[model samples]
Target: MLQNKSMIVKLLALLTIPVSHATGQVPIDPNPFWQSGEAGVYSTGMIWRDCNNDGYIDVFFSNGNDMALASNTIYISQYGSLLGTASWYSANAEYSGHCGVGDIDDDGFPDFAVANYLGTGGFSTAGLSNLYFNSNGLPNTTPDWYTGDSIYSFSCALGDVDGDGDLDLAFTTGEGYTTKKQRDLIYFNVNGALQTVPGWQSTMFTEGMDVTWGDVDNDGDLDLAFCYDDVAAAV
Candidate 1:
């Protein structure tokens, strides 16, 4: 958590330019991509975290697959400047699908988790997805996928569902076509590994797309917020 870390990031420098009267109030230039109809970057999920514990928020983007030349990237500053980036397929089959981030281990530092969907939307296959935990915030090594289904959607939310002090993860898969249609699941941390809570799959949270973790009830323990429907309806 690095509670004492500085929140203000020190900028290097800013240069000033003399203004010439091109016009009274210079007309704003329309966004080139918007005006020219150029295709923009497509991202599925992202998270804000101080990866270095330096107080600067780093951006982690996910593309959900290994296709698309530049599907996954990490940026530090604005205007598409690259800080560090990596390819997802550079990891084990245990982790090669959807990706996300959160304080999964409750060590105060944020960890990275990737859901290895294996480029498929089915759930019958085994060893399909996993989560890699970065106890430290470095991105040099491949991520670990130690939880959830690999063939279907590998989404996660962080919270303490059973009143434990440590944060736990809620996972889901099945993709809505399973015989039970019960992809919703909760993994309560036992010592370290994520162990599924009994009856978690029986929860009523079906047909959800995005799951956000927060203290909705303000009970000190984190709560859950689910955004249902598909991409268009979500937007």
Candidate 2:
């Protein structure tokens, strides 16, 4: 009976040691569960959206900047698989700075808009904004429309500001190498294309860097907000 009791005490000691170590402690995995190959070189401005309405989110990436290897292309991934790539404009000397997704034509499918900061023609001449409309819920490589010359676009945002059923675009711009500041633009969607809204440019004197819209006053109307790069005070 004495030997049995001693053996039982040793067993309980081992069990209690493990319980003390595990108290308030959580196990963590140290190894990576998954990995994937690099999609593109010098990639920037990545965004995920439900482009095809298949309930699975898709990804879009822009590979730009380097002239030798830069394709100035947008790569798409659907359902965790690469769905090919498309370039809507001439890739020569073009850096795809930023991109935004929205339904510009009220077609229930998300479209893509990109800002070409510096193109082959150089800063002042090559800056432009391009828009690609999604056709039949698939990614379209071709741009439906592009901004006029000398637009100098940088970052873009999409929203419905006027309570209209269609989406609108607000983009920022600035001189690439000079002190000249550019005005922010608001393009209203009209008849499946973007039209410039008059007197919508920001009156504050600053170099626009980014833009977005929200109803800040609880008035149900969307108010625009612009972020500046050189302004001393918040606007």
Best of the candidates, lDDT? 2
lDDT of 2 by residue, 1-235 (tens): 0111111000001122232364753343334332223333345555778777877766554445322224334333445554333323233334565678888887888888876555546553546677778877665665566775555555778888777677888777664355547777777787567874432676654565666678888899888776766774233
Candidate 2 residue spans exceeding 4 A from truth: 1-41, 65-93, 124-126, 196-199, 233-235
TM-score attained by model 1: 0.58
Count of clashes in candidate 1: 9
Model 2 local distance difference test score:
0.58
For model 1, residues 151-218, the per-residue Cα lDDT tens digits are: 34435566667775655666544344343233555667665556534336534534444555677667
RMSD, one per candidate, in order: 10.2, 15.3
How far residue 74's Cα lies from its native spot in candidate 2, in Å, is: 5.2
Clashing pairs in 1: 1-108, 128-150, 129-150, 130-145, 131-144, 131-145, 131-146, 132-144, 132-145
Candidate 2, residue 165: the lDDT equals 74
Poorest stretch of ten by lDDT in candidate 2 = 5-14
Model 1 score (lDDT): 0.46
